[model samples]
Target: MSFTNNIFLLMEKSLKKYGNNVHYSVLKEEVLNWINLKDGGIYIDCTCGPGGHSKYLLSSGKEIFIIGLDKDEKMLEIAKENLKGLKNFKLIKGGFENIKEILEKEKIDKVDGFLFDLGFSTPQIKDGQRGFSFREDGPLDMRYDITSNLTAYHILNKWSRRDLVFIFKNYGEIKNCERIVDKIIERRKKKKFETTEELANFICENFKERKKIHPATRFFLALRIATNDELNCLKKGLENSIPFLKKGGRILVISFNSLEDRIVKNFFRKTECIRILTKKPILPTKEEIEVNPLSRSAKLRVGEKNGK
Candidate 1:
């Protein structure tokens, strides 16, 4: 077997022993709801992650054509392994922003179901080395794709106070963006914002409420969203996808924050092509949150394509 296959086998063995403890996967039925769905229909999983939704949908004894989409190559590789030996499932290593183009290329005019579970996975945060979580001290690199040129390393130091303040204020919702920006600018001039620890320390020193969530939390979020163009991507993806969904087809999005949730909310509310199934998002259960603390912020909203 190839190296990718080896990784899959290793993960499978680990999962067999540990269940879903290690990965914290969302599980198939929880998100996809196979019993409520149809078979042999086309479905799209925009975030794809490790293919839990796709695997669940296919395993429900259904003959479905599924596409798993993501921007990160490493994560895509992991999805490939979990979805190995499935001929009906196709994995696309691309951003959800291009979902329309992807479908058009496949010669598919429309699909029955679409899913987008936004943000990073557990393997991404818990690994601590990826630098996505402020709790974990690693390099300041938060780029979703390591192959990408821009990173938190560059943004914290290079961006002007104006840009820094704007992102912190808008994205992080950091009430004290000015203070945070000032600190970042002052510190970076003497040394550099190359590591996560340096940035975290700067925030702690400058902000009074840093202890609540590590002052770097929102700043880092702003940087990550700006670097990846996440909101813009979601907008583009939703714009492109509306036309490609089959009549009565479903669009399910799991957003991690208010910004992303708002995007999905507005798009579904305004668009003629989609009818909102969830006027309000479905949040994770208290039990789920208790079991997996990472699930606290998760919100799920669903939409259905109108007019066949």
Candidate 2:
């Protein structure tokens, strides 16, 4: 086998040995049900993290060709492994914001459906090295594509207090954002923020709160989203995808937080070319949440392209 294939084999082996615990595709039935794919043509998975949704779609025996795109090469490799032996699929290393360019390059005029599952993947959060989670200590790097220059470290240590306050308030939606900014500025002046645990600990120590969730959860989320430029990318991706959808073509978006869901909801509401399919976002079944706790916050919304 080639080196890439060998790597995939090892990843597959590791997943199997560990009982494949890290990944779960949420609201599979709801997504499939909402998207009418009776005569499947071309479907695009915008995020395509580890091929969870794509794998599920392919296994449904639908005669569809899938184009999977992701910014992270590591996730793409894992997706390749997850989708091994699937002939009618192509994987590309790129962000969904460049969907128009990618489709043009591939000579695809339009697509029958699109799937966007927004947020960090399970492996990313669990790995710790990617610095997406506070549960484990790792470098303060939160870029979806590691090749990207900006990192959580830069934001924490180098950004001005004004900029930090903006990020905390707008991105994090923290009520007392200025206080958090003051604390970050104070802490960073003494020593540069280095690791995920260090920053998370600092936030926890400075901002004491009684809540069901961790005090640093929103703070970390804001940093990750800003570091990756995720909101703007989501907006561009949604706008660029509209013109390329075939009449009656479906679009399904699974958002993990209110920020992402609002984007999808507003896009569907304002775009005349598409009609919202679900009146309200669909939530995962209690059973699915029990099996995959990470899926508890997921909300799925769908739309169908207006007929020409």
Backbone clashes, each candidate: 0, 0
Point out where model 2 deviates above 4 Å.
Answer: 1-21
Give the 10-residue window scoring lowest on summed lDDT in candidate 2. 1-10
Best by TM-score: 2
Clashing residue pairs for model 1: none
Q: What pairs collide in candidate 2?
A: none
Error of 2 at 162 (Å): 1.4
Give lDDT per model, in order: 0.76, 0.85
Q: Which stretches of candidate 1 lie over 4 Å from their true place?
A: 1-22, 27-30, 34-36, 85-87
Candidate 1 structure quality by residue, lDDT tens digits, 1-308: 54333434555565467654245545234566522467778888888777777777777777788888878777778778887877688888888888867888888897888888888875676455678867668987887778878887777778888888888888888876786677667777888877777677777777775334545667778888988878999999988888887888888888888999999899899998788877777877766754555566788888888786
